[model samples]
Target chain A: MNGFKIIVLAKQVPDTRNVGKDAMKEDGTVNRAALPAIFNPEDLNALEQALRIKEAHPGSTLTILTMGPGRAADIIREALFRGADDGFLLTDRAFAGSDTLATSYALAKAIEKIGRPDLIVCGRQAIDGDTAQVGPQVAEKLGFPQITYAEEVNIEGDVVRVKRRLERGIEIVKASLPLLITVNGSAPECRPRNARMVMRYKKATTLTERQSANEDYLRMYTSHPYLNIEEIGFKDLDANIDDCGLAGSPTKVKKIENVVFQAKESMVMPATDHHLDALMKELIINHTLG
Target chain B: MNNIFVYCEVEGGVIADVSLELCTKGRKLADQLHCQLEAVVIGANLSGVEKQLYPYGVDVVNIADDPRLEPYTTLPHTSVMIQLIREEQPQIALMGATTIGRDLGPRVSSALHSGLTADCTSLEIGDHEDKKNEKVYKDLLYQIRPAFGGNIIATIVNPDCRPQMATVREGVMKKEILSKHYVGTVKNLEVSRYVNDSDFVVSVIERHMEKSKVNLKGSSIVITGGYGVGSREGFDQLFELASVIGAEVGASRAAVDAGFADHDRQIGQTGVTVRPKLYIAFGVSGQVQHVAGMQESSMIISVNNDPKAPINAIADYVIQGDVNDVVPKMIKYYKKNTK
Candidate 1:
């Protein structure tokens, strides 16, 4: 019932929505240069849940923690525009190509450095990987319980009640404090940026971004420390280099292939099902069901 | 080489559909690896259900029955599976990519210091070579899946880890019953003894059933929209067209991400995989992830302003017009025709 410290985990992903023909290279790897980077869709859903909890608990503080390149600081600014107190960008070359395991390890180290939080909210999965492993893995590494596919959450006494969306139906569950919950895309959609907050924090920059900024803006970020989003690297979290990125990942991608199903296997039909009776019977006979 | 183990999940006293699909795939993989195809079911009082395994190509079935395991919390299931895999040392283990499997697979694999590939669509037994490193790992579990939202396919291999694991989505493979052969064996286990009360950190307080208004799986005609639907009002036109064609309304991940529709109605990877007799897309440009789930529909019709949308490639009929402009016309024409 009291105010609690909350951390929201977000990611900056390629805007695959506007995928072009050249989205992938001959090697099957993503052509990062061609696509624009945007906030992961579900992570915005996660931040909305965190914002909801913060709204209910008046004095609660919500912080954004994301692990990506320095440009990932954009997500922090995005979060701040929607009412987050602070954020940290876990960036460094060492964190590249990290599978869920290594990604969780580095994130867990970052979480530990931030100290104990009453709740940790993350999206069910990132659009890029679609693994859904990092959330539970961080809970395992942190020795805290986790609730996945959470549709709704609320505070009751010291226990956080969560309604989980399972394949069959919904189940309401309860757990103690210091728990992690992965928000589903089914959760409430996030609010658009507030015009006032956007105008206020539009000048926010990280130390890395400041390197490319003009002198006047650098002086402004220094004068208003809040304008400088905190940036942490591998050394800051004390993460082992062996367990931070590609080196720590166990799974290896051996090959990539392009696939396009043949339309010739299917028949072209007009919008009107004028031959409805015949089509239905044919589908039934073919075991497509009546 | 060791046997391949498929963990069967039971719901409402019946085996899940994905489990049976696992048996079909496991049997093929087992034969390729020269080992037996084994299955393990964890639930309460699942005595007669072991009979269902042999018909699905399982040569051996193991049941860990416990009343506490009925609804399935994370720890009790993970404990039994970890113990079972350690004892059998199966070279490959598989589970469905359901809510339970996704939560449990990562924990189990991490605890065992192995690797897990989630949402794999294809599995094969073959050699994996790191072409860049010039190293070849022979006879590995070739775990193949859609990466970067199905734009590309990546075949992964956990060469050094024992018991390579994967969680496959339902309906990815057709399930078939193999005739009872060679009198299969069954073993009842007492795995509940290993689980403690502390293991269940989060307990179910209540259960609520929110059956969707439209069952996308059972509907014969499906009308799907994508981000191109634009807004919530745009999605209303989609429902109007669905009502005219007697089709269930569905959305692509794009629409769901755009907050124009609910998640359950989203048709694609991480959402429901639907194979209706007729699938119509309105203003929907199909992403690879969305196409992976709905490409099997009998008659696919795509409507979009852009002629080169990916969904257009797989569509049987392509209409190059904005969905907003076209859907209302379809509704008016259908209303004029015979009911």
Candidate 2:
């Protein structure tokens, strides 16, 4: 059996899970600068699945493809440090404010540009949006079958078996080659970065970054061609400008507001046995509790 | 006809609660827009399924009963839904935000070039003014949901899309029967016409779908823990207290993610929306997402060391203490006060 060509889609998202007091602006918008940017957690799980497949296939190669600002290349490097062979950064001003559908269109176009692979794996959803729509939408755009909420994936010959973690149960399904899989967060966490891999790919930079690189780094890029991460922008793809970004997105945000609760004049009570007994007695008498 | 269409999910020959909940909401939206409410159920042995839907004020029920359709596969379901939606030209389309709906909604929306919002907390019929386009659109479906990790609420609209699509999680909307005597027409679909042979490429090899054991929504009193609970053993105290008081145990996403509780026990914007008579929080520094689920509780009592915990703002009783200390005391007093 030949090794499969696999691509893992990843995102660099703000750590919204541990949002701090400074995480939100006074105007109710996310303060991106205050939040630390890291590789989306589920996407890392997807990367782990991709890496496992690569290890199993011996000659297989895993590529990371991410769409965001130039800084998103950080996650690509992060993936390379964890055993990916190479990566591509899809960035352009045209892709700003893209909803799930438009983002899928742009990613599908980039995938085509990278040449269709045997399998495409990505997290079920991005933390920031939590839509869980991109993976299936991309599969639909590329005319491939999708297996979502996959906790485990194994390939035998041209057939791929996936174990999906549904809300209430588990299911094992099988499909042929050329498929897309959206891994659930319940999947195994990604392996830690290898020291050797990090030393080798630490200087990996996209063309945009290369232009802004120091002289010594520029010379190293010439010597080590692999360090030059491929950068794909709007000009490189045949995607219609209208269908690649905010213009192509059908959903529009009409308004955004900070979550505010109607505050109750709460009766503060000390954590004393007396207060506890009284509270319980009061609840029992009022039939609020027994 | 430009009616409201809900893509009902069926499992084990029964319509999912989320789908019925959407039907209830859809019926309301249909009434507001003065359009018929329609339901599309695709699965095996769906005979007389419309009987279950009509009481929700559904005007029409579309059934595609095929053996291969049960145990949903993405391609076939998407094909059936897309073809049906295109033919009906519904002004609005809604679905459950379960694993099946999250998978199928995007594909169908992508194929039709329509927009889809997932896990919407609220749906409303309203008008939108596109100031840039200088256009006023009436009766647009407003898809309201918490975004950016549930710190903010956003109202989304698809002004130009033919069928505005949105997916709501189970229990987010109330399920009410309009009338038991309500009647609806049934339209049986020829499954082969909408789905192709290639659509069955993915085959289910094995399946074990157990009914969810947790009954958070049905519980009258809920005792919940957050990450501050410290460890899984820390949650044992909560369970002990719940058993003594005849209450159900719930957890915030943080606690569940920390492995203190199972995902099914999660309560938040992404999890179950519960409105119990009494909600007691232990060590919960509430994020808006968590509060969104339980704020409707008739009485909220928060126990935490942090006096400024966001949950305390909405809590009717703010008990300043640690769960480790307060939980045992509450359990002791409950036993003492009871017969």
Candidate 3:
């Protein structure tokens, strides 16, 4: 089997999981600035999966691509430090407030510029929106097969076998080449950055475009030109205007509300195995679960 | 005007509990909007699903029951849902945020070029005076969910789309009860799209059920230890106490990192969000992210030597002593009480 090229899609999002007292906005939307910006957790899991595949196939190259503001370059650097072969930062002023559809378009264009990849991996969903739509939508835009909630992935010849986590049990699915996988948090944790790789590639590439590198720093990335960051723009990918932004998005938000569930909550149950069985039966009988 | 539609998810030839929850909720929203509530059931052998929806207050049940829909695939499911939405033109649609709902909702919303809100905690009816269909067009659906983690709540509304869509999280809303002698209209339909073999890249060979004893998310009494628990031995005390109570043992994110417990048992933003009835926190300083998950518990008891620990703020009962000392006493008390 030939060594495959893989790309991991990552996003830099506000850590919405830890909203504090100052997290609210005056008008009730989320005060995003109050939250810390971090790399999407599942995306790191996706990167781990990609790195495992690369390890399985020795010569395989793993690439990281992200679309965000300039600070997103930090995630790219983190990816490089972690042994990714290449990185691309798709940053542009035009890409803002892009829902899944528009976000996928930009990512798909960036993926196209990177050339054909055997596997395109992404986190199942970003925590901020929790939409879980971008990975499948990107695959749709690129006209490829998508396997979501992939807990485990294995490649057998030309076929890609994956364990997709469903509601009741696990579904073992097999697809042909050139597929997209959206990894769940259940995937194995990512390996720490290699010490040697970190020393060698700390300044191995120029990504921000705005940064000025010193001579010693410039010498580090000069050896492997392939490791250099490729920043693609809207014009480079030639994305369709109607399919790229708010104009292409059909979903509209009419109103936003804050819900405080003031329920009369109480439970009547004895804490024992027998009591638990009876409680389970009660819940099942009440149709809460079965 | 077209009525509100609820995507009744069925697995193993039975309607999912969340679908009933949505139908019940959708019934209220429809009534608030002054529209009829309709149930849309799409799956294989979905014969008895319509009758079940009636008790939940569905006026009409649309069925797209087919052999191809027997085992769920994205292609067939998305095609069926898109076809139904186009034909019925439902003003509002709701689905549970289960595996199937999460998979199918986005695809259908994308194909229809509409906005969809996922994992919503609340749903509301909005009144918009756009001169379209006056009744249906004037009605809006507001999807409310906790944003920026669970720190703040956000209400999002999609007004322009014909069918307002939302995939609600499981356990967030209450499921409706089914009464006897319930009846509703069921209309069976076929898969309308020309789905080619080329479109589907993957084929499901088999389903394997991996039975795991521990599911911290659904446990009633969750005993979680944190970094302050000191070592794996400290977490073992928590597990012992949990076993005494016939409960599941969980860990804070720090405990999982410290190898004190498995990742599956970790409760927080990065792990499972549990709303257990009785949450016993041992040596855990409550982080905001961790609190987001357990804040809704019926009762919280904290055991930490630090009197001013953040966990004390949220805990209903605070034990100002070392968990190593306090946990054993609690276990003894529990044993004595139970006996």
Binned by DockQ into CAPRI classes (incorrect, acceptable, medium, high), candidate 2 is: high
| Model 3 DockQ vs. reference | 0.29
For TM-score, the strongest prediction is 2
Candidate 1 Cα misplacement greater than 4 A, ranges: A20-29, A55-59, A191-203, A212-228, A263-290, B180-183, B210-213, B218-250, B258-262, B275-286, B297-339
- Model 1, B1-339: lDDT tens digits are 279999999966689888999999998888888899989898887888877778888888888888878787876787788888888899999999988889988877766756789998789999877777788887899998888877877889887777899999887766888776535789878675557677777888998766557698888889898888899999999888777667899998878877799877978766777888889888777766778888899878788787767788898767676677777666654554434
| Cα lDDT of model 3 by residue, B297-328, tens digit | 87777777876666677776666667777777
Per-residue error for A47 in candidate 1, Å, reads: 2.2
- Predictions ranked by lDDT, top down? 2, 1, 3
Q: In candidate 2, which residue pairs clash?
A: none
Q: Is candidate 1 or candidate 3 better by DockQ?
A: 1
Report the TM-score of the second chain of model 1 against its true counterpart: 0.92
Range of the 10 consecutive residues with the lowest summed lDDT in candidate 3 chain B:
B130-139
Expressed as tens digits, the lDDT of each residue in B63-141 for candidate 2 is 9999999889999999998899889999999999999899999999999999999999989989999999899999899
- Candidate ranking under DockQ, highest first, comes to 2, 1, 3
Model 2 Cα lDDT, one tens digit per residue, A129-198: 8999999999999999999999999998888999999998999999998999999999999999999999
lDDT of 1 at B94: 95
* Residue B227 in candidate 1, Cα distance off native in Å: 5.3
Best by DockQ: 2
